[model samples]
Target chain A: MENLLEVKNLCKKYIGFELKNINFSIPKGMIIGLIGENGAGKTTTIKAMLNIINKDEGEVKIFDLDLHQNEKQIKQDIAVVLDDSFLSEYLNPKSINKIMKNFYPSWDEKLYLKYLEKFNLPINKISKEFSNGMKMKLKIATALSHKPKLLILDEPTSGLDPVARNDILDIFQEFIEDGEHSILLSSHITSDLEHIADYIIFINNGEIIFKKSKDELIENFGIVRCDEKDFKSFKKNDYIKYKKNKYEYDVLVENKADFKRKYSISVIDKPTIEDIMLIYIKGEK
Target chain B: MAALKGLIIKDFQTIKSYKTTILFMIVLFTIGGFLNDDIITFIPVTMPLCFEMLAMSGFSFDNLSNSDTYIRTLPVNKKDIVKARYIYILLFTLFGSLFGLICTILVQLLKTKNIGTEILISDLSITSGAFVGIMFVQIFQIPIMYKFGAEKGRIIQLVMIIVLMLGISLATTAIMKIWGISLDNLAVMLKDYLIAVLGIMVILLYILSFVISRRIYERKEI
Candidate 1:
């Protein structure tokens, strides 16, 4: 199948929050980053896709098969690492290996040991004693040992140091090298996604704002910084969202080329994923 | 099957962490029984208690780690997880009963000079009863754990026990009235087949409890 995973009209409602008409798809051999703030329904979407929680309404298809009908077979090819959930904390890496062996038919002991060594994780030390970075590495190691075709990680890089984050990014980069693997990693850390993600699925307040290619976001999208007069002179339809600053207004444009062609403004700063997200959240339409 | 094996191994690892505490308690109780004749009965009771704790502690560890969410991410389904839990509890119960029986006999031989036949039979019955109690405990405890979680389940279990006791009494009286048999007459009439009947009830209860626990877990939002 062209798309490794697809979600359609996914809806989940809590007391005060709801994920409305959520939809996205992950094509093969690509990294799709789920970027959203805390309580933005990123984790909830992941949980629903994996059957961890009962979604109010939705249809999830993995490997072109219905998720509810062929769950076990579908799960054999998917691995996940949740930010705050894992196997028992009382177990060490060695014990985790023993337990994982029985769950996956393709579990590779050699690869697991290699990851433990590469990550500098002690075999016998309980996971509860590991630092946040170490714990993330251990989780990543376990997730990789199964050699799954798809890896879903929820905030795996949160609270991690830059060096550790780079190491994890490097591993994810290597993971998709074979052109058969895909990754759906959700994180508030947009900078990391900027480095490796091919597609960015931005969610705000449980609603998807956009799902655009990273190249399109970095190349076509631009921010126009101008004085009040220049901002007022421009038509409202030219900009997507605008934020008023002390001395200037920063306007987010969908097409830098079209924006530059329309306005005579010279200053069009490049926008990062975070800057785009900030404009969407903090700026007015 | 492999998923179930993985779950069982996870529980074994959790049980292993309590090694020092388990051994210490068992040894302490055994020594206490050897020193005092009155304490003998309670020593075997410790065996069933220890293993029951071992089985239940797995749920506590799972709660602390939020492993149920992790398990859902794996190839395991809710039914297999519940089945694995039941199997783990029963395996430990069997082992615990054997250990308790051996230790009780050894302690009895070491402490007293002559063992009366009647006392021996009653002692054996008590040991068997304790293991049966362990099974019944799981039948009640597993579904509660699956529904409310390991922490809140303890309080719920207490409430369930009281309700269950009241239910059993009312059920027994109703049953006697419907059959037109007094308690004394029924006991005398069923004495020969009491063990077999009880065994069947135990098996049926476990099956029914497993179904209930699985249903509760399948709908639970981890």
Candidate 2:
């Protein structure tokens, strides 16, 4: 399948932080979750892909069209929701509807009103009076109303209760049900990604640590806990990285089935997305 | 075209949202018209001064809402954003002129005091001066705001307006003194040729400003 979005060797440098040679691809009809610690360049990468910020080096392609050249055309079919809803506080949804209706070629008034109703957003109330969840929902409603094929959401589910988050996730699931739409969602919440993500991309500091399918990550990745003597006996290449405790060493291996076959005596346990990220970040070679 | 319309519509909605501010300006203009003949004659000048305030309000609101990032995500290009703002300045000027005209007519019909042809000429002078002043400020201010953002750009705009106003006033005084032309004669000279020159200059400045702002904003990081 053709990629809905692609970022190749993306690089952006700041005074103290850098997005270093970042790369990722989102296939059509799939949700790709970007997970990272704060200042790990997740926002930077998203901004680069969206051309919100100029990338120092690299290329971004949306629907196989070069982003910089076909920006206006490509942007028509793409929707973005930043951390801030970015709506003027004084403008109510009614006014916003009138303003935004002219912005997109495929704007669906019925869909927008439906989302507003489903989200329980007051049509006449200014955005200033909204709760954070309501603000997020408003943004989502606006994004989805335009009939975009690719949705780029930055921390959309952050700061929401589980119910709110689930509601949003369900909307995303519904969005991709047509098999023609896709989402690139960045969040710190690992469980949210675990529940809805098809592929998980982890970034640490400024670089991509790994990008793997959720099933492959869940089923194949493992943690091996053993004494120092037993840990040293295993080949150095067997595990990607390891953390040492007072009593034993915890090793992170990519493939549990192969690792277990090679060392039948060592115990292997399944690792969660959080566990994998922590071990990758906190553990050392 | 639709994207540009959307942007203009958004800014118009923003202006509408500032209900208190618009109401206050209207009341102030109406009261000024009722109390003083000079105020009625200079309504065009005074109205744009209000619009300058309106422009400032728009900038602050854009910053407050973080609309720059949001606007970029739409189908509109950076150039379109710049164009829309220029269109907005034109719309604001048109609105101000219309409001000033209505008040001038109200002052004429409702009051016993009538100044005849001299007031008409004075009104023209004031209207031309206001158009030049308002456009001058916007031409310099928009590009600066695009480059530096609303906060620092506003300071630059204030300083530039002051400097430009002072310089124009001084230049006018010096020219009149050197040429031995009375104030009325000079106003006549402006009515005949200077308004046309100023109008052309304003258009050129607006075009230049649009280009410069588009460049600044295209390169700006959200």
- Winning candidate number (lDDT): 1
Off by over 4 Å in 1: B112-121, B166-187
Summarize candidate 2's per-residue lDDT along A50-140 as a digit string, tens digits: 8888899999999999999999999999999999648688788888899998988799999999999999999999988999889889999
**Angstrom error at residue A192, model 2:** 0.5
Model 1, C-alpha of A71: deviation from truth (Å): 1.2
Docking class of 1: high
Taking all chains together, each candidate's TM-score versus the true structure is: 0.95, 0.93
**Per-prediction DockQ scores?**
0.83, 0.73
- Docking quality class, candidate 2: medium
Error of 1 at B26 (Å): 1.8
Off by over 4 Å in 2: A227-229, A245-248, B113-118, B166-191
